[model samples]
Target: MWVNCRRYAVQAHNIGCYKTQQRPWVRQLEATYDVIVKECGLFVDQKRPFLGATPDGLVGDDTLVEMKCPYAARDLTPLEGVRKKKKIL
Candidate 1:
């Protein structure tokens, strides 16, 4: 008879994978929203240059949306640089 050791580990991994899959749902929702906004006469500006590898987002004559999504359970350290608060020491 043989004993299995990683059964729980494998199950946890599967659950984690399932949780991660929810991320795409959020993305799809955002895309749908942006499209609706653009189609509603937001009029995206196309002449602007992109600065990074990420999507530059929709920029209309009167609107701009620079967006990103982060995992709730993961570190959000990257956001710190986006809006810096000057420390008063």
Candidate 2:
């Protein structure tokens, strides 16, 4: 369990760092969605400090966005495979 948790933490950190590099794309999303994306802070439950969330971006009043910037080759490979299968079918 500890090992899994550590692995998840590292994965989350890597993805978070990658997302920071994709701010332009995120800004485009905000423009397309017509929502002002606000910076998010660590939100902790008063009753349970350990239970907290640091969302990527907050939209307007109630929406939260978690952005993923996947590697282009990895992201396109599955879509290409699906397209090929669709052509066969």
Candidate 3:
């Protein structure tokens, strides 16, 4: 199970077309961004929250770097999915 999960994580990094996965490159990007921050004098918000809008990493106060990965070619967004659910009601 562990091996399978790891493979899936790796695969998530490489989106074929519609699938967008950001976990794989998250660390790399974070590190790069961190170094860029360190050059100045800032840190990331580790304890904030994981709301969809929370940036993957932020620089200072003006920059927000949110990552994304699409699930499929036609998969609706969170809002769209919610709208569809409402229609069912």
Give the alpha-carbon lDDT of every model. Answer: 0.36, 0.60, 0.43
Writing each residue's lDDT as its tens digit, candidate 3 over 48-73 gives 63322323455566775545554442
Winner by lDDT: 2
lDDT of 2 by residue, 17-68 (tens): 4545557756776777677888776677899966766677888887987765
Q: State TM-scores per candidate.
A: 0.22, 0.58, 0.27
Q: Which of the predicted structures, 1 or 2, would earn the higher lDDT when compared with the native?
A: 2
Instruction: Tell me the deviation in Å of residue 29 in model 1.
Output: 5.8
Instruction: Score candidate 2 by TM-score against the native.
Output: 0.58
> If candidate 3 were superposed on the true structure by all CA atoms, what would the RMSD be?
11.7
Clashing pairs in 1: none
Candidates in descending TM-score order: 2, 3, 1
- List candidate 1 segments past 4 Å from native: 1-31, 34-55, 73-89
Instruction: Give stretches of model 2 more than 4 Å off.
Output: 1-20, 70-73, 77-89
| Model 3 regions more than 4 Å off | 1-23, 31-52, 71-89
TM-score of 1: 0.22
lDDT, candidate 1, at 50: 28
73, model 3: CA deviation in Å?
A: 9.3
